[model samples]
Target: MTDDTLAEGKAADREKWKEKGVALRAFFYIFGTHVFAGFVWLLFYLGGHAQK
Candidate 1:
C-alpha cells in the first residue's frame, strides 16, 4: 500500500479506538454516579427510620 493510504488507515483506526474509549469512559461515569446515588439513598433510608 502507499504511504498515504497506510497513514489514512492508521488515522481511522486511531479515531475508532478514541471513540470507543470515550464511550466506555462515559458509560463508566454514568454507572458510577448511579451506583453512588443508590448507595447514598440506601444509607439515608437506613438511618432515617432509626431516628424516628
Candidate 2:
C-alpha cells in the first residue's frame, strides 16, 4: 500500500502491456494460418482442373 510498492506495480503493468509478443505474436499467428489455408485451397483448385 506504500507509494514505492504502487509505483512498482504500475511499472510492471506497463512492461506487460508494451511487450512485443502482445502485438507481433497475434499478427503472425493469424496471418500465417490464413495464408497457409488459402495456399492449400489454391493448390487443390489447380490440381482439380489439371485432372479434367
Candidate 3:
C-alpha cells in the first residue's frame, strides 16, 4: 500500500478509538461511583455494628 493510504488508515483508526474512548471513560466513571458508594455503605455498616 502507498504512504497516503497508510496515513488515511491510521487516521480512521484514531477516530474510531476516540469514539470508543469516550464510551469507555463514561463506563469507568459510573462504575467508580458505584464502587465508592458501596465502600461508604460498608464502612457505615461496620461502624454501626461495632457500636453495638
Of candidates 3 and 2, the better by TM-score: 3
Instruction: State the C-alpha lDDT per candidate.
Output: 0.98, 0.93, 0.98
Write one digit per residue (lDDT tens) for candidate 3, span 1-52. 9999999999999999999999999999999999999999999999989955
- What are the runs in model 3 whose C-alpha is more than 4 Å off? 1-13
For model 1, the superposed segments whose C-alpha errors exceed 4 Å read none
Q: Estimate the lDDT of model 1.
A: 0.98
1-52, model 2: which lDDT tens digit per residue?
9999999999998998888667988899999999999999999999989955
Clashes of each: 0, 0, 0
Estimated TM-score for each candidate: 0.91, 0.60, 0.64
Local distance difference test, candidate 3: 0.98
lDDT order of candidates, top first = 1, 3, 2
Residue ranges of candidate 2 with Cα displaced over 4 Å:
1-10, 13-20
